[model samples]
Target: MSSDEEWSSGEDDSQPSKLVRKAREAPFVPIGLAGCLTLVAYGLYKIKDRGNQKLSVHLIHMRVAAQGFVVGAITIGVLYSMYTDYVNPTSSKPKK
Candidate 1:
């Protein structure tokens, strides 16, 4: 037997190649925050006012608070998506 044949750790070359995978989705924060936000909005909606004059004011206040929370959560989701999927510089520096 040849020394060349004896030295080889052989592997077959007949398999088809596969493409690299697309990036994975971010796990849970966006959805969890969304749920909590919904619950808060519902709670706000269910608050009762004794007078009709104050009910409109209460609903409006609740609506504004819910809308603000939604906007803030959406902003956070956008920034997180951008950081995970688009902002790969291969390294990060820790804050002091």
Candidate 2:
């Protein structure tokens, strides 16, 4: 089988994962990923100095940071879409 067929589940335009499609269309996905990685790295660095602290606590914070970044990116994308669609439409329409 070809690489495309292998990556996709079925013989359709829709890919196996929705995240892949969104990452292609949305610009914020890369930024969100970078932010998440930075937060996780920071968490790791902070945890390394404190051997007495529970690892689970630091892990939870990392998870929260990642989720928060994803949520924020989605929110910004939605708002920007709304603005382009309603507030400042770029498409030209004939007046009725």
In angstroms, give how far residue 61 of model 2 lies from its true place. 1.1
Q: Provide the TM-score for each candidate, comma-separated.
A: 0.43, 0.61
What's the CA error at residue 8 for candidate 1, in Å? 45
- Across 1-96, the per-residue lDDT of candidate 1 in tens digits comes to 876554423343223211111112433345545655785668565775335647677767666766676666667867876775679534333457
lDDT of 1 at 70: 61
Q: Give the alpha carbon lDDT tens digit for every residue of 1-96 in model 2.
A: 766544544654455456677676787877788888888888888887757778898799788988899789878988887887898786524557
Off by over 4 Å in 1: 1-46, 49-53, 89-96
Score candidate 1 by TM-score against the native. Answer: 0.43
Best by lDDT: 2
RMSD of 2: 8.0
Highest TM-score: give the candidate number. Answer: 2
